[model samples]
Target: MSRRYHRKSRQFMIGDTLTIPQDKPDIEFLLRMTAVPTIDKATGADKKVIFSGHVLVTIEYVACVPDGTQPIHFVSFEQPFTGAISHRSARPDRSIHLKGLMEVQELQLVGPRQVKTSLQLKVCSVKLVRCRSPLPTHAGEA
Candidate 1:
């Protein structure tokens, strides 16, 4: 038996604060930022589907310096997140497939050595039923 079903996408917000190393210079200004989200596991229970994942965030910025010349620096970190969605056909026996899209909604510098970021994740769930067919005993038999 095989069946397909589509449910409304679920959205979640993840926030994190990063502290720069003591040896590194203070952040002067941000140049660029990027975030990538990955789904580690998905499970169904009762009438809901749950998922857990992590996001990799990288930031490029200019470091404060005594000289007028500007120096560029980069910092990267991972943030873990978890969320759940309600569905009519969700069950522990059913397999779930998840597709996710992530966006960096907000980025702010809390201080000279701290950075804050807010990320939004949108997840779409697909339920799949796998069927196994028995093989014939003889090659000629159908």
Candidate 2:
């Protein structure tokens, strides 16, 4: 006999544009992200996933040195992101959750010491409830 179960999943996406802090001039910036999961609320078979995370922004620039040469400088900043994903399932207690992935779509140097960035994110929502069929009865057992 083979065992089986039921599973359901859905995917959601979001996009946004943001500006870098104008603290210093930057030649380039790289982004790295990680997802932090949070449950927003639960009501009548509906729930909200608070998709939040931190972005590591690595900035590279040129600095003037006393020897009449320029040295490259590197700096990092941790930025936070927050969004909500709505989902509905029959059972919210048995392994129902959301997973998020992020990507930087575009980054441009818009002005001196400023940059415009665009991001795209995908959220996968999964719900695994109880088994669909009943278990087989053993011989001589009720």
Candidate 3:
């Protein structure tokens, strides 16, 4: 009689290493980091859904300058991730909607020229089913 829906959420971790160019100034400290996730593909199976996508990570840091001034620099990179979510209502015939959220969990400096970043991606899935009801025979039929 009523519409039915199923929901599931999954979390994934993505890690990447970035190397600074020789022409760029040395990194003095990190200022801020952000990430954005994009879903590339999604597939629905018997009772599970598989997804693959990439996250764009941006890093802003203060670079050491010879002029005794702190200069801000930015670097961006893309990292790929894949994950799956299982739901009892998930099926090839039903429709599934996906939402993604990403956060920069950790950042570490491996060396003067390299940096390691850890990102957490949260994916939410909702399965929708169409509800059908019999039409009334007459306008006032109860």
Candidate 4:
């Protein structure tokens, strides 16, 4: 499915998978504003959020802290609904997980960040993976 997020007069359209990285201190929160899935780490306890169908992935990033002590802050947004299931599952967060050791170009992928301002960043890499849906059922449930 196709979706859009409007922030600071900029409209970002991210479909399937999107990657973004930051290496400088500037924008502080994932493109000023965006909608991201709420991960109920408590009761949800779902480290792996299995999604299917057409998924809209949005990767937002904030400016990196000057010091290397604090890890850069980045968040992924996903809006998925029932559709043709062409892609099955998409995890923009995985790109964050796979950071510090890869590059979008090396992975044959590109991030959706403004090149003009994004220049401040030394982005190592960003990645988005498309795969089939997991077992369409809850854990321990038949």
Specify the highest-TM-score model's number: 1
Taking the tens digit of each residue's C-alpha lDDT, what string does model 3 give over 81-125? 889898777766655566677643688888777889888778777
TM-score, every prediction = 0.78, 0.46, 0.76, 0.21
Ranking by TM-score: 1, 3, 2, 4
Question: lDDT tens string, model 1, 60-103?
Answer: 98999999677999988888988898877778876777666774
Q: Name the candidate, 1 or 4, with the larger lDDT value.
A: 1
Candidate 3 pairs with clashing backbones: none
| Maximum-lDDT candidate | 1
Give the per-residue lDDT digits (tens) of candidate 4, residues 105-128.
Answer: 101123333322110101111223
lDDT of 4: 0.26
The parts of candidate 2 lying over 4 Å away from their true place are 1-47, 63-68, 90-97, 126-142
lDDT of 2 by residue, 90-136 (tens): 44343434444453334555554555544454444443344454333
When summed lDDT is taken over every stretch of 10 residues in candidate 3, the lowest stretch is 133-142
